[model samples]
Target chain A: MADYILGVDGGGTGCRATIADTSGKVLGTGQAGPANIMTDMDTSVVNILSATDAALLAANLPVHSYSRITACLGLAGANVSGVAAQLQQALPFANSSVVSDGIIALQGAIGDADGVVVILGTGSVYISRRNNSVTMKGGWGFKVSDLGGGARLGQKLIEESLLVHDGIYKRTPLSSALLKHFDNEPHAIVRFAHDARPNDFGQFAPLVFEYAAQNDPLADKILKQSVETIEAALDASMHDDQPVLSLIGGLGALYGPRLSVRYQPRLRTPQADALTGAVALAAKLYTQTAQS
Target chain B: MADYILGVDGGGTGCRATIADTSGKVLGTGQAGPANIMTDMDTSVVNILSATDAALLAANLPVHSYSRITACLGLAGANVSGVAAQLQQALPFANSSVVSDGIIALQGAIGDADGVVVILGTGSVYISRRNNSVTMKGGWGFKVSDLGGGARLGQKLIEESLLVHDGIYKRTPLSSALLKHFDNEPHAIVRFAHDARPNDFGQFAPLVFEYAAQNDPLADKILKQSVETIEAALDASMHDDQPVLSLIGGLGALYGPRLSVRYQPRLRTPQADALTGAVALAAKLYTQTAQS
Candidate 1:
């Protein structure tokens, strides 16, 4: 049996690792650079290794202690990458397995209990767990869907900015600021959007919330539409039994208060972060198998 | 001086040619293959030449007659390609120049008269002409702004279908039909959307209309949003003098009756097609230069 358990939460923006005793007691944690395996597996591998090393060092464990660890990694973009299955071979840990970053978030939020978790960051994902059965919905990515995610909000703002330029929509305070970024050229907006990745689109989402605070009509309109998407996702995710619901991610708290009235009562603060979820999962997976 | 004026309208889907007498009398017309200069200038040149050859044949003129013709071409994607300026050197015409396809659309709908023409085909372009001056709005292309264009309508429907799959939106008659296109796999929808071009998205737009005819709630919702976009574009295009308004393109007549009541009084059927407008410009340009 492994002497220690390692948990990894890898995402497009960053990578995190947590080390613990076999029983799941906290030991140490560390974070590293972007680890989106789908776009760049080599980079993800390097960052994941660095994150694990940092966690080991922080725990005052020997450099070769990784040989005694059992790891379960939750990584973003795992589905599209054929390289993910081979990731275990490349890792320093004794045993490692890969799952989606969303799963880690789900475990962190609801923990083995039956409930639902909605992550609203650059992308959006809704996952529900009932009777230990899990199902995922939404999070189809930015172009076709992201719904309440920041990337979609930012893209929607750019789309609306063009409408303002075309005289289809009335101008608001945010219009000038948004236009200034594109140099008042609608073609520039189109060009930027043409090659922009989801992260690029997400960069402008904060501007909408800022302008909405000032009572800008266009901003208000955009936020309202976004809030509705969040509400809709919640409606689909929650059941008649009313499972415990938690919103997690950069925009999670931001969207909480603005959600429809019915969702307010059901919304609960997440008990832990994805890294914590990853570590917990690592402990459970290894301990159960080790005993058996 | 050139004895004949040739007008060419080149688009993403097809190329058209018109040959007329110097006095603006129509002599003959021809059609050929796809000619979007932005994506494929070489193709556009080939199709334009073929269209010209066919028009000359229909007019009972020799192939060499192209040397005696002056042409003005309105082409799709003229703005994006520097090759547009050099098109005169590649063409069979004696004197030639290039302009946006939208300009030809405007001239085709209103002729020398002042009015606004909204082209609502696979994509959308809105142009207004007044006091012999012209200004264009919208039609920034898909992914950013097409407003009420069919590509946008279709893309919007696909996005909605995913929402239905996510349980965010309820299943309707249209939902099953849409999911079938992707083999009922949400990830397939994501993959298809990642690489889908504007024309690809446009293909699904007709489905929205088909389901709307049956009173499918999702279809009705999608169409209503699309109509609002079209109406918004119209409001921006219209002026106090209330110049004639024409909706021209594949979905033009379909959207005509669905327009807000306020626009009904101002709406007028287009007088001609883009090919006719091109020939008229060719005649005017050469005849004026000849007199000077």
Candidate 2:
């Protein structure tokens, strides 16, 4: 009975949904608020539904036409145990599957082909698909992991600035500027960090890259460290028979060139965005279920 | 008139009070729960009072005799802008001085002499005294600073374990043991870290040392990193005319031997504990006030 495929990409900041036909023709797109399931499942579900309703309305479909849609949701925090199952159970659709945001990103970047996608957004994750199997590295979250992500880069910047404050590290213009951003008050930075989310820390990441571009020693050091970590993660995710690698997300382009030349030729542009991949997956699921 | 001097060392874990006469002869001691001023000022004050009252009772003095005590409180979180002044105003005593826990630890370790005390407990701070002036390095806090503290060491351990899980870092008994402790579920570790306090992370520190002693490569790497950071902090705190260096706190002895041999000859045994240093400060304050 499904007439349309719905692709949803949900994260801590916001949610986006797209409506497409089986032939992959886009019908409409919509957006809503944060939908990170682990933090607030009810809110995430609500946001997902709201985005889907908007997409359906934009497609000139009735609000009650959800039963004719097969949805594939790729969400941040969906990898947490019980989240995907709970989300699948809660969704109001003809057929739906919930997966991690990274998976959709990988699929969107490379389509049905076997390749790798390195997501370098507020957080980081390296996901690779081979044949029909997929594996991942990193993206373990912030403070403990997400080594080369924007949040980690910003966090290290704050730490180095404090070290400069304590005379443990040589002060630089980059560090001085970072300290000035905090009003030169270490306690204020501490207070801010205590309750900071990943995005809050990620806000400082662009400054790091900007300073590094000017050959600021401290900024260069931080970027080098981050690059090394990302390289290690990419290396770990690689297999002998691996396909092309695509860098994705906000910091993807910034990090791309900084990576070693060995990885340059292996990098490929993503064929489509995550929402397109989500719809592609929805279409595949609809066809398979119909045959079954 | 005040007849006795009181020294109080308060931290995030617990509070300790020592009662002494003007000559620094220890009379009695008492203990109570955490008294970190910034986190909970009212509880800190209450715990400080409770510990002082118990110390008085143990010294065979009446609890009502608090007005006769000149108290010195060396408290964690007192370095924050208004914590010391706020705590001083809230005290119930003949006179009181509130200084950082690191200051009292340095004073207790070397008496009136000049020296540096490197505190390596649940948190870290390097305090140095030269003549009548004092300076500090490191000990900004955990996750931002506190580089070589137990919390940082444990945090590194968890990070390595996750890397091992991701195959980015090689597996070792140390990493395996840590992963097992978390039920082999990465999500469990993430959940624990989401709400973890410094002490919670510090709880895993001993295992890192234990594994290093057994020659676990991953453990050795973490320790080396921590030692390097600590050495940097120690070097930064050292002045041209710096006095003896004393290592203090729970992991002090463990880290002492691991430090570079060049710094070994500079280390000295503490003359007394932080509580004793606190009492000495109280006595000194009382004398200065009386002379004025």
Candidate 3:
């Protein structure tokens, strides 16, 4: 009988699930709707279940093939007091452990080493790991202090675009693009913000990155400021002179290679994605917890 | 005929109108409903008329008794494009100039001199005046910036309070007080936010300030952070090494005494409130425009 493991990285944008074996080989992966516990808990659970089922089916496993299968969820906002407990009770995993999405991402990226993991997707978080100790720097939601995240960058883009549109500042190609994209209606944009979630706003972040890639000054400034926020978070969390660093999440992987050039030798490549790490953690915990 | 001049500072919490003579004698004052432009334009106009009517009634004068009444409106959200123009057309006055509340506050304190004005009420704005040229730093609506304002402070208080109520953080006296005050149901507060206008949230800012004054660490942190935001805005907008500064708006005036110790030599006491400054500007502009 094949010993199977499941891992889920449930983020604000979507839920990603990976089916793997005990030897750490990924068999299949699947995705579903947003799985952030903070915003929509019901949808998140449904998405997680859907993604997991798909991944298992993709791995060619029967519905009840592996009764001994274990799962772990690295879920966004699961660390908010009773959230993890509530989610554990809600999800369909018979043998599972629920932890913060950050912890699992850190584990996936650096395994058991001392390092800083900065996840910058729709939301952003900085996690420092050292010898079984973990410290979180920032993740104060999208409204308050999501400095280097996609939401932050998107907001900046919209604000700057408005400035240029209003003739308050010099027009740039970014402004023109934003005006075109948003149909030049400021109030409509504001109304859009009233309805859109963090992840929805994050969809526009790639435009800023693309503009930055093309060396647009405003876009360059946006990227510079964003990098500074991430750097500051890392500096505050990591006390060591030269701590190993890895990146995860949507933005982190997208910009990880380029970011490595900025941080140079201190930056190390991640061993696994958040989903793989979650699966590994699940299998490891099931072995210990079940035995205990 | 008495050459009476009226000064009206219409805010989110309430509308305050002062009836003073050309000799700068304080005759009477009146208050009414919230007059922030962001709330509802018609309501603000009605509030202004009501407050002005009350001030006139209190002064034992019939309507239109004043020979020359020039009113300055330092209105919230007047900074938005075309909003000031709309407000100017709405209000009934011999002469009126509509501007951001920060502008009139700066003028009230420093007249035509170079200065920085910090208007802290439901929202906050920093304005710089240098040689007749004006510059604005921050105050990009309540959602994006307005960091030190009442709404932002209230949000912090509520967030912290909720965290403690949920047992996410170690309970502090401030948190306990907050929970007791809100009856331990934060969703109720969220409901209030949905139904609230700008001034409604601003009303709770005093509670935080009161707690801070009582030496509560969490309250102190929040209040201190708010002050820091204002200070940063001032610093960003200030042109010279030593620029005159003014504190306007209800919260600004209330907190002005506390801030004076920190700003000391740079903080210039206002000769009149924003209303008077707005009146002065209106009179000047009305005459200039009429002659032209």
Candidate 4:
């Protein structure tokens, strides 16, 4: 049996790997470039391997020790057709399984409990687990959905800025800042958005939040609309059993207090990060198989 | 001086060319494949030439008489930096100029009259004219703006369909039809959207309108929201002298009755189509230069 377990959390932005013992004691963690399986499977595999190798090296283990490690990889685009299967077949670990990044986030947030985790980052998704059965809402991606995520917020800000430029929306300091950022050229914003990825748009999300704190009306309007969508998503994810809710991701804490009062009592902090949850999953799967 | 005037209306879907005498009398018209300069300038040039050649042939003129033509091209993506200049230099005519597709649409709708034309096709844009002075409101393109256009409606349909699939949104006949169309697979919708262009999403716009006609509540809600945005755009377009309002494009007629009653009295039918408008502009420019 493998003496070590590995966990990988891969997304469009980057890939992170954690190495731990069979008993769930973490030894080291490492990160590498993006590993979006849907975009490029080969690159994702390479990134996963690179992150794993670095984690093992950080744990004082030989790079070749990869073959003896069982791994669970949770990655964005894993839910796409044939992506997870392809990644599992391409992985170098002794035994490995691939799942969506949302699943790992849910695992990390609730740790086998019946609950839900709403990740608000460059993208947004709601992952719920009840008695080991898992379901998901949203996370269709940036262009089609992701409602209240940073990317969506940033996109709304740009749209409002352009409207202000056109004299359609009232000009405010927020819109002025955005127009100035793009050199006061509507075409520049259009050109930038034409080829921009979610993370690229998410970079402007902080500006929206910053302006909102200063009571900018447009910023406040954008945030209010965003929170309404997020609230709707949260309401849709609930059940009579009242699963504990944990808001997770880079923007999670910032958005948490703005959520409806009804959800206040149900909100809980995550027990571990997604990387730890991935390693925990690896340990659970490998140990069970070995005992059987 | 050029003996003939040529007008070309080029867009992502296709390109149309019209040939007319210097007196503004139509000679013939022709069409070819898409000529969006931003995606492939070479293809745009080829398509434009093909349409022009066909138009000359239909006009019973020698194909080699292209040099006698003064062409005015109103093309999608021409407004992008360097595109119009590149196209102007590449066009095969005695003299040529390039303008945005929206400009020709506005010209077609209002002639030389000071007015506003709101185009509601696969994309949306508001173009206003006052004493030869032109200003634009919303043609920023899909995913960022184009709020009430076919592409946005179709994209919203897909998003709602996915939400219904995940039980986040209530299932209606519209969402059911959409799910059935994609074989009830959320992944299929995701895959289709992942690589879909604006026109691809625009293909689903008819479905939304069809369902709305059948009184589907979800469809009505979507349409209401879309119309509100469009109305906001129109209101923003109004100046001290209320310009004659012209609603144009494939979805324009359908949305006309739904607009606020205040715009009804001002709404007027277009005097000519975009192709004719292009030819008219070509005649006006070349004729003036010939006389001068």
Candidate 5:
């Protein structure tokens, strides 16, 4: 029987590792670089190991203690065909299973209760759980998907700012502020965006919400359009038999109040985070297996 | 007097060089890689020389003949502050002047006559000349600008296709066709977009126009929205006096017919390509100086 359990929460921004005892008591936590498997499977795998090693060290366990651990890894892009299975085979843990990042975030947010989670950070993912069956939408990544995501919002902000710069669109406080941030040079913003990652774009997301509150027309358009995408996703997942709903992530709070009135009453704060959910799942899966 | 004249047209897609004698007869022409100064000035400079050397070779002129060549380079991003001056200092020529790509295209289109040119390719730029004064709009680069250009159109196609895949958007022929191109896997598209350059996305542009002609709803929306941006840019650049307007570049022909009725009467064909404009300007500026 394994002596401990390991949980990994990985996404576009970073990877996190949690080590806990069989009784579900947390030991230590650690973090590492980006671990979106679809972006780079090899890089994700490397980051996972690095985070796990850091967690083990924090727990005062030897690196080889991975042999005594059963792990549950919740990874971004785990929904892609064969990615989870491939990762399963590659891990050094004694026994481990892989699940989507959305699954863990849902698990973390609602615990054992049936519910839905709209994660709106650097990337966006919509996940619902009813009677333990989970449905996931979006969270594809920054390139083409992740509608209503921070990266997309930030991207639009910059794009619109340039339009304002060219007088093609009327200038607003948001565009004015963004132009100033880039030193009033559209080309400077262009240079920043050319090599920027999703999180880099995400940094500008809060400004959209901040400006929208001030009645910035451009910001209102950008945010409302994003909200429309989010509502559409929610419309598909929030069924007739309503489940508890939670909004979670870096931009989650900002987006929560912006959701349509139909969803306002259903919204609840998450009980915990994806890392916590990962740790709980690891303990339950491994300790139960040991007992059986 | 310079032994030969060189004309260089550089943009995001590639650069072209032409070598001719003082009498305005083109001796040879050559092409090289992308030379958008905003994107990468060093790369642009390198491509300019590579294309020039090939043109010189074709004209039976030594590479060292650059030292005695009076040249004019019409370059994308030349309007960016200090870029043109920096480039002028860096070029190996007897005498040279730098102008925005729009300027050369304007010269090439109307031959010192009053007119406007809308270049719609992997990128977009609006340029108009009236009474020897030039007005340029857009053409800032793909990351934050290029609203109606091929790259932006293709990007929207992929983004919408993913929405279709998620069932948030109704499927259309255009989305279906694009999904098929990416092997019906949204992840493949996400992968493709992660590292896709502007021209890479531009490759799918013609397909949008093709599908739009069939009344594919998504394609129509995408095309119409792009047309709106084009019209807006034109509205800013096209004056009340109504100068001759020529739509040029890879997608220009497709965009021309779709323009609003207001621009239809003013539409005309480009007299020559950007390279030809560069050559004519080179010959005019240098020959005029030599004669005087």
Candidate 6:
């Protein structure tokens, strides 16, 4: 029987699980939706398990075929008190480790080393690892912080739209274009705000960047403020004189240039995804628990 | 017949009005809640009227008693389309003028002369006035911009609270105190967040500041970032070779020391309130309109 390892990145927007064999060969991957443990714990757990089953099927292996199975899941809202226990109890594996989505991101970015990994997806977090010990820097879950990520950018975009609506901001083609995209509905803006989530709002960030690229004042202002927020987070988190910092997640590429300009003197991109690091950590954990 | 003026300054948190005679003597003042026109149009009008009534009663005059009464209402959300007209139609004064709250703030600070006025109350806006012309700066409202106001600061505080909740932020006395404060009941944080206005959350700013003064790392970080925001707003609003800048609103005094330390050579404190400026403008308008 072949031993297997699985790593899952469960986010607010979606769920993704990657499977690998003991020989470190990529087996298969599976995807699902709305798997943030904080907002929808039950659905997230169900989706994560379904994704795992799908991954096993994709790999042409039955769940019970492996002599040993280890899984690590990095999930949104997993940092909420008692969430780890809840997730672990819910996500079935021969052996499972549940940690905040940030932990897996840190592991994925720099395996088993002391360093900081900044995740910029629908939300953001900074995770630092030192000697198998984990320290987190950010990822307050959309209600508070997560600056320079998608939601923050999106909030800025909507705000610009409102300003254009009010004539406080000089409307550019971009502003008009966005307003039209929302059907000129006055309540459209308010409704969006009412049901807004970090990633849900983050979807508008690219538009903001596009407008900024086109030299719109409102968009430009939004971009600058976003950059400043991310920079400040980096500054607050990277307290070491010379810390090894990495950026990951969906917005990672989009925010790269700005982050580089502001923090490259003290930061660098990681070479791996959080899933990979999670797999590695799970394997190590298996070894440790097995030894103990 | 003692000519009187009615002055109003309606912001995000409340509406403030004053009754005064032509010599700039303030006879009475009144306040009412949450009158930002952008959020509550009818309520904003009613708040202003209520405040006006209160001011009249305070002045021992009937609403219709003052001969040659003039009014200037500097109102938030007045920049919205047709909002100025709507407010004018609702106001009781026969001779009245309306403008964005920013304009009245600028007038209160520099009195129609060329300079910049940075108003930092529940929200923030910067205005630049030259002679009879106005070149508006910041004050995009809470959704779009508002660099150094209580709302932005409150937003930052909420973000920090999330960070602390997520364990990304280091545990500090400030965090615990904040958590305890918000932990009025189970899931009180969530309930508070869902219902919180910028000012409601901003009521915590002084607490954050107090902790920072006592050397709490997280609080210190929050405030330093706030200061940077003010600096940025000032920078973006003022063309380097432009006129001297003035600070107004409640937060101005709190921010003055730090702002002065950095930009003292160019900073001035306004001696008048937004309502005073509105009254002054009203007086000027009354004399002109009567003569015309």
**Clashing residue pairs for model 1:** none
Provide chain B TM-scores across all predictions: 0.89, 0.93, 0.74, 0.92, 0.92, 0.84
The reply for model 1, stretches above 4 Å from the true place, is A11-16, A25-67, A77-97, A240-244, B11-16, B25-67, B77-97, B240-243
Report RMSD for candidate 6: 7.2
Off by over 4 Å in 2: none
lDDT (0-100) at residue B29 of candidate 3? 75
lDDT of 2 by residue, A1-292 (tens): 4388899998988999999987768889899999989989999888998998888889887765888888899998888888899989998898999999888898899888777899998888999888789998888888689888999999999999999998889999999999999999999998998888888889999999999999999999999999998898888887767768899989988998898998988888778888878888998998998889
> Fnat of each prediction?
0.87, 0.75, 0.00, 0.64, 0.79, 0.34
| Candidate 3 lDDT | 0.73
lDDT of 4 by residue, A202-265 (tens): 9999888888889999989998998998888878887758559899988888888878898888
lDDT of 6 by residue, A1-292 (tens): 6678888888766888878886567898888887877667888878887787778889887844434678878776676688789878765577888877788878777666676687887767677665556766555545566676788778767766665664455777777877887797545665566566666787887888787778888777877887776766666665564357777878777677766454666566676887777777677766766678
Candidate 3 TM-score, C-alpha based: 0.67
Q: Per-residue lDDT tens digits of candidate 2, residues B183-216?
A: 8999999999888888889999999999999999
Worst 10 residues of 6 chain A by lDDT: A234-243
Candidate 5 C-alpha lDDT tens digits along A29-115: 789999978658888889999999899889888765778898999987788899899889988888898999888888799888777
lDDT of 6 by residue, B220-265 (tens): 7877877776676566556655567787777777777767364787
Top of the candidates by DockQ: 2
DockQ score for candidate 4: 0.61
lDDT of 4 by residue, B109-139 (tens): 8888888899999888999887678888888
Give the C-alpha lDDT of model 1.
0.84
Could you give the C-alpha RMSD of every candidate to the true structure, in order shown?
A: 3.9, 1.9, 7.3, 2.8, 2.8, 7.2
Candidate 5 chain A weakest ten by summed lDDT = A234-243
Q: Which candidate, 4 or 6, has the higher TM-score? A: 4
Give the count of colliding residue pairs in each prediction: 0, 0, 2, 0, 0, 3
Measured against the true two-chain complex, the DockQ scores of the candidates, in the order shown, are 0.57, 0.74, 0.09, 0.61, 0.65, 0.18
Q: Per-residue lDDT for B204-270 in model 1, tens only?
A: 8888888888999988998899888877777777786756999999888878887888888878999
